[model samples]
Target chain A: MTLLECKNISKKYGEKEILKNINLSLPSDKIIGLLGKNGAGKSTLIKLINDLLTPTEGEITVKGKPIGVESKRSIAYLPERTYLDKRMTVQAVLTYFSDFYDNFDRQKAEKLLAALDLDPKERLLKMSKGMQEKVQLVLVMSRKADMYILDEPLGGVDPATRDYILNTILSNFAQGASVLISTHLISDVERILDEVIFIDKGQVVLQESADELRTREGGSVDEIFRRMFRC
Target chain B: MDFVFDNNIPIYIQLVEQLKTYIVSGALAAGERLPSVRELAMMTKVNPNTVQKALGELENLGLIYTERTNGKFVSCDSEKIYALRLEYAKNISAEYLAGMKKLGFSAEQAVIYLEDLGGEDFDTSGM
Candidate 1:
């Protein structure tokens, strides 16, 4: 079944159109990479799906219904910026997520926290930038949602920690649920992606299976992206 | 136990090859239950669908079998495994000879070089 579909979606901010007539359908039970360069309106599309921003001239749907509170219930969203409360301890944050999201899994979150070696007593303000990012990702992934939308989950981190984040994202998702991850670091997360959507200037230039793309292009996904979007 | 994919080759093909390697190398013994698709995906850091496709190919090749309500298991027939090992050795030998030929070495010269490098450890295998 289709997990999400955007039909002729367009976004405009005071006459400056960020997205054109975009039509895309994301299927269930797959990990899709949303790839784009900076200022290419990748974030605009993600925000539309998450229902954080309204579309200008089109409609978006999740699981055959319009994106609304019900769609939001089924989608776990992790934005590009940090939104955690700086004064909350790790344990307190866990409680906050559990209280806010009925679908949140406390035990799973605790296990992930332990795997990342994050102390439950440590305050969010004391954690380094990288640690904070990981914590935020853990909170988002610990929910039993039908779809996961992560914006720049791999942005600005060391290579070692990047692998850890990818592993966490892959292992934590429930079976048959879809994950839409927006990222510019193609090579770093290419292995885990089933499909890739290449957005350029608010339009989807290409959407293809990762393996098929590699075979047809005769190069890594990152290499293909560089050739396609080279300055 | 390590899956080092170069990411250029098709991932499912690489996965099938790696699982076959594990089976023939005895790293995954005959009749051993294959890890669940999710577990294998976690270990390899790829989509579960990719791993599922690889496992399906292995089943087609008679390298593994799935028992309903149970799980996937490596083929228990040792003769079948031995045949696979022999075929693998033949492919490796052909490639090795071709590489040596490029370096201006005949079969006899290749043997001599192996002997000079103390080829005693290779005696037990079918060289």
Candidate 2:
């Protein structure tokens, strides 16, 4: 089933075009890697999907309905920057999510916390950056949402923690839920992705199945990316 | 337990194939506990999610089964490994042949090349 659709979507920031006539249809059972260089509108595209920002032109829909607060409820978003208040403890974060998202699975959140060896009472402000990232992921993935839009999820974690974060993302979620992961670090998360969408200069250059692209291109996604974006 | 992951190939696919080899070779014995996802991640220095994906693929194929309290374990059915190996081999052979054909090797030339490489004498008994 098509979980999300963006049709001829365009966005502008102070007369500078960030997204140009974007069109995408996301299936419910795939993990999509959104690839782009810096300032390629990857973040802007995500915001449009989540309805955090409206398109200057065109339209988007979630399950055939227009983008709105109701659509946001079915989507779990992890932005590039830290969104949690640093003073809140792990337990408090869980409580906050539970209050906001009805589908928040407390048991899953607790399980993830236990696995990560994170104490619920520990304040976010006191934890290291890597630990805080984990906490954010835990809260995000604990939701039983139809779509997950994670932007730059692995931007700054240590190598050791990055693996755990990835594993938690894979193992924690239910089947058939679509995940849209946006990042320039393609090699790290390439294994779990079923499809990829390459964006450049506010335009989508390509979108294809991961396996098909690899077979046809005769190299890794990173290599293909390098060739396409080479100066 | 050792593998060289090609950037072109997905990490989970490499892990799945490598684990299959281990199973077929009996290196990872039936009923043996596989490494925790984190442990494998730390060992490979890859993302834990990559390791989890590999493990998840194995579980889906019935080559590995998870025991909730004890973690993931190798399947007791040894034949399953060989079945998986056969399937993997067929896929590799098809891709290899297609690649060779694309490189201008005729069917006859490819077979002759395989024969000259002593491919016929190689053991196919395992599968």
Candidate 3:
């Protein structure tokens, strides 16, 4: 079933168009990798889906309802930047998530924390950047939401941590929930993705199943992406 | 056992295939202890979550079993692994042959090429 849909979505900052006439639907039970260059407006699209920013000219719906507090409750978001309070300990951060999200699975979150070797008492500020990213992912995945929007999830992490983060995402989360992951590092996430949506210059250039795309191009997703974005 | 991932295939699937290879080859002996998720993640430089997914998939397929406090171990049932390996090889070989045919190679020519590439003795024993 289609869990999320965006219709004729458009956004602008001053005169610069960030997203233009965007329309997309996310089906349940798949991992979608959203690809674009640094300024291809990938983040803008994510913000629109999470309702962090309002679209200038369109509407987004979650489960047939427009985005609002009710929709937000069923949607888990991990922004590209650090959104967690640095002063809070790992335990405190988890508690905050539990309080806000009714579907938050505290046990699952704690299990992930233990697997990552992150102490509950460790302050967010004291943890390394990679550790912090893992913490953020743990919280996001712990929520049994209908939709998960992860922006640049592997950004700035070492290769080892990247794999761990990817694994965590794969292992956690209930079936039938859709995950939308936005990233520029296509090669890393390409293997886990069921479908891929390529955005370029504020427009969705292509959206297709990863396997079909590879079959059509006779090459890997990264290769196809390079060709599509070739200068 | 170490896993070599292909970007063309999904990581989780690649992982499942790799574990199956080890089990089939006996390199990862039945009842052998598998690496911890953290250890595998650190080795592969992948997220622990991805590793967990791979392991979870294996468990679901009954190719591996978890011992809770001790960690996950390779399943003792050898036939299942062998069967999985056979199925995997059939699918992969079929895909490869189909691709070769699409490239204009006849069946006989494809077989000849496979033999010439020393794939006849292609050992599935080492995983």
Worst 10 residues of 2 chain A by lDDT: A167-176
Question: What's the chain B TM-score of candidate 3?
Answer: 0.70
Which prediction has the highest TM-score against the true structure? 1
Docking level of model 1 = medium
Instruction: Estimate, for each residue in A1-231, the C-alpha lDDT of model 3 and write its tens digit.
Output: 989999999998899898999999989877899999899999999998888999999999999999999889989999999777899999899899889889999998999899888778999999899999999999999999988899999999999999788878776767678889999999988877778999999999899988678777867789899998987
Write candidate 1's Cα lDDT for B47-113 as tens digits.
8999999999999999999999799999998899999999999999889889988987778767766
Docking class of 2: incorrect
lDDT for model 1, please.
0.92
Candidate 3's residue-wise lDDT over B11-101, tens digit each? 5567777777878778888999998876776566444556788899989989899997999999988788778778978988999899988
The residue-level lDDT of candidate 3 at B98 comes to 99
Off by over 4 Å in 3: B1-3, B8-127
- TM-score order, best first, reads 1, 2, 3
Error of 1 at B45 (Å): 1.3
DockQ of each: 0.70, 0.18, 0.15
- Which DockQ value does candidate 1 get? 0.70
The per-residue C-alpha lDDT of model 1 at residue A126 equals 96
Q: C-alpha displacement of A156 in model 2, angstroms?
A: 1.4
